[model samples]
Target chain A: MDSLNSLIDGFGTALTPVNLLWAALGVLLGTAIGVLPGIGPAMAVALLLPVTYGLEPTGAFIMFAGIYYGAMFGGSTTSILLNTPGESAAVVAAMEGHPMAKAGRGPQALAAAAIGHFAGGMIGTVLLVVLAPTVASLAVDIGAPDYFAIMVLAFIAVTSVLGSSRIRGLASLLIGLTIGLVGLDQMTGQQRLTFGSLQLADGVDVVIVAVGLFAIGEALWVAAHLRRSTGEPIPVGRPWLGRDDLRRTWKSWLRGPVIGFPFGAIPAGGAEIPTFLSYVTEKRLSKHREEFGKGAIEGVAGPESAASASAAGTLVSMLTLGLPTTAVAAVMLAAFQQYGIQPGPLLFEREPELVWGLIASLFVGMVLLLALNLPLAPLWAKLLRIPRPYLYAGILFFAAVGAYAVGGEAADLVILLVIGLIGLGMRRYGLPVLPAVIGVILGPAAEQQLRRALQISDGSASGLVDTPFSVTVYGVVLLILAWPLVRKQVTRRMAARR
Target chain B: MTTGTAGPTPGPKRAHWLRDHSELGVSVLLLVLGVLVLTDALTMSVDLTQRGPVGPRTVPLVVGGGLLVIAVLLAADVLRGGRGEAEGGEDIDLAEPADWRTVLLLAGVFLANAVLIGPFGFPVSGALLFWGSAWALGSRHYDRDPLIAAGLSLVTYFVFDSLLGVPLPGGPLMGVV
Candidate 1:
């Protein structure tokens, strides 16, 4: 009943003409950018962050939420149409989707993807509404030491599990931490590593770093690598799904949300794992296994649904516990903090309007996305035909404008360029950029909790492990950190035996 | 595509060399970066805590120590010639060479913005910024391209200036925008 009332209140807020317009705009821009290869939701949000600076907090967040989900929808189009995936989560979709396109059943493949996205998105939102409060209440009892332990666990999990190489991921994370440590030390009010510069007093904006790395670096990389080709646009054909297609896909859509939600809620579990699992599940379960690498509609439907559901599931954890499961969630967490509204257990009590409004807007936005994407997917496909040179150049131009708009400081442009180069290097070296992003966003918060815990214990090293909860949290962290090594050893032994 | 090719024993000697050398290069770079960060963190002034056992240096020092350990491990792995499967193996072959022409064109666009933003102001410069990028991207259909870019820049200008009140640089052509 309480959830219902709050949802209704949220609908009231979201239905306002101004808020609705923002939601529509967010989804539109998110889909457009999401369709672009190499750009993801995090980059899209970061690019739009500067532009949203002046909107009311509630309105701004509503739009941000729309863009986040909109990216998920937009990503599937490229994955299915082209073999190229705009986001890592879309990789599974591409495996089956591209084959389906090649078989000339492109429209059916896209229809299944859209319908599956709708199903998963709706289910995930329901879970969020019901689970967020309960989880947030549990988080309220956690002390500073426990928080510190959890952050350590987060850092370890993200660096080790998210990327191809643990060493490179950790290195990238440390680099982000180093960047976070720039400017004034939060505790001492003393400037450290500022090198006697006034601009350094204010720490580098995470938004600027994110935008520069994702948008600017992506633009530069695209500009330098994109081939200019005028390929004929893939014919979208009929948008409607046949009865056989519908019957085959509905089960996968249901199965996907079930499989994806829990993974999205977990710390290290991202969209990629669930999406891959969903794809494999569909392949193994399907009556038509031979069609999987050909033009299986289930193959396209399952993973696309899983990806969108996982995206929604990430929001549940983010809004309630302030733990971001993906890069976009991490950036959104920063955006929330920028508005001075910490999203946690207290958010429901303190700002019910904002929380519910954002949630309601998501439901509305999902519907809007379906309406826009389903009938007009062909138009979106035409977006792919845009020459690479102009697309990338536009990205760079917008990135520069966004960076300059933030602080009006000339030094920011230099920082943007430097970070862009670092981003390029990370991409080249196969380092996961998400961990670095997470580290930067969470570094200060973790430091604050650690300092607080130390103060409570009177600076004793044992103080960190003194409490039962903290001890348990540390134990969990150790287990997570050790799991990879232990698993590797087991795998090696098994390989030797084989 | 032949499964019977040499019983699937990793790769050729040249492949092994390439793998080991790249890892070595990366390990060296990581070590350098780790050491620089560690030294910088350690040199910062720290106030001793009379009441608590932990101080401001705790987290950085721990992170620094962790980095050093990882660096050492990475170095050892690289030196020992432990070759792992190449990352993104599927896509590596698909990647094409860098397009320098597009890079230069984009660079020119940014340079133009930097030079003109202060003098020509937001309206004129903003329009050029949008139009130039659009043109560069391959929208040779100038009839609709410039109009679309101009509209986008104008809306952006209004949103930044009027709605959000972000105080964007209007430059010399401010009133027109």
Candidate 2:
């Protein structure tokens, strides 16, 4: 009953003309940028963050929520038309979407994706409304050991699951942790790895790290391979679905949210796993199974919905427990920190208006995304035609400005350059970049929790493992670490038997 | 493992050997980074505080230790002929030799922006960056390119400075902006 009143008040806040305008603008700009190749939601958010600095916290976050959904919606446009999935989550959409586009069902493919995104987002938002308070209350019961253990699970899951090789991922995570270790320690007020430099004392900014890795690093890597065009994008018409298409799509959309939200709500949630699983499920369940590779409407509908649902799912942990499982969510956490808003159980109590208003704006943003994207997809697709040189150059231009604006320091630009080069090397060597970003964001938080747990237990190492929640979290981490090796052995044995 | 170390041949075999060991750079890079972290942690100044037994040094020590272990393991794996898969599922052609010229050109453009942005300010420096990058990307419409670059840079300068109220150095256009 109390939640219902707050949600009503939230609607009142979000319904303001200025706030609605911000949502509209955010969706428009997000789709425009997201349609461009080599730019994803994380990069878009990181680049646009500086623009939101002057707004009130509520208004700023409303726009951010809009951009988040808008980017997800726009990603499918690129995947279907260009066969260039900007991020891994959209790779599933590309599998059947591009083929649909090739078979002259581009409009239908786009319609399925946009509507699926809408359904998933709306249902996920409702789930968030009902579930967030309960989860946040439960999260409050978890002590520091459990918090520390959860961070360990996040670290292990990201390193082991996202990338092809565990070594590279772990190495990247170590690099991020090292970056996080810089500046003064929160409790003791002593520097760990600042190397006595005044500039280093404040540590590396997450925005700088994000822009360097995603924008500048991506541009540099793409430049190295800028020899040939991938292919001409399939021309798409107005996004429209027939009665038959809608009938086939509705069940998949429902199934997608069911499958996607659980993966996203976990501390270890990433969109990649859920989207792939949704694709496989649809392929196995479809009545027209032979059309799976060729323009299957169910193929685009299910995975796109799953991807968006999982994206919304990531917010559950982010809001309730202050954990970010994806790169974009990491940036969102940084955005929250920028506003001095720490999302956790107390957030709903202390700033009920801000939290509820943000959630309300997510629903508003979804409606805005669906309304804007259904017709503008063909227009947004034109963004793919931008000259590669100018597109990347513009990226660098914004990246430099974004880095410079952080602290108004010249040293930040140099740091961006160095980090960008490191990012380039990591990309060339096939290392996953998300774990490093996650490590940088979560490392300090995890360390603080560990220290707190130890302080309470008089420095006894066993104190960290005493709690059931902590033990279970650590057990999960161990299983995640060992699962790949065990699976490899099992596969090898099967091969030998054959 | 024996295929890499005990065998030598020219042609495709030699190329295969190079590919197999290409990731030595990554393992070596990890090792160097691990040593750097440990050395930095060891040399950091220690100061006691009102906070209890867990000092700031503890986390760094643990992280540095973890890095060293990962480095050693990665090196061993590489030696045992384990190799990372080349990036796939993207539009990139990893098989083609890297086009260093364009990359270096773009790098130079970024460096030039860094050097020029402070002295020349955002508008002038930004336009130069835009034009230079377009050229790097093989766009050679000399007359039209500069015009677009100027328009984009000027528009950005105004929007950020006036509407957003974010201070950007305007160089010669400072007073006008």
Cα RMSD, each candidate? 4.8, 3.3
Among the numbered candidates, top TM-score falls to 2
Runs of candidate 1 with Cα error greater than 4 angstroms are A230-232, A466-469, A489-498, B1-32, B47-54, B77-94, B99-116, B119-155, B175-177
Candidate 2 whole-model C-alpha lDDT, 0 to 1: 0.82
Model 2, residue B20: displacement in angstroms? 5.0
lDDT of 2 at A50: 78
- For model 2 the interface RMSD, in Å, equals 2.0
Clashing pairs in 2: none
Residue-wise C-alpha lDDT for candidate 1, range A312-380, written one tens digit per residue: 798887887677888888888878877877776678888989999999998999999999889988888
Segments in model 2 whose C-alpha atoms lie over 4 Å from true places: A267-269, A466-468, A485-498, B1-20, B47-50, B86-91
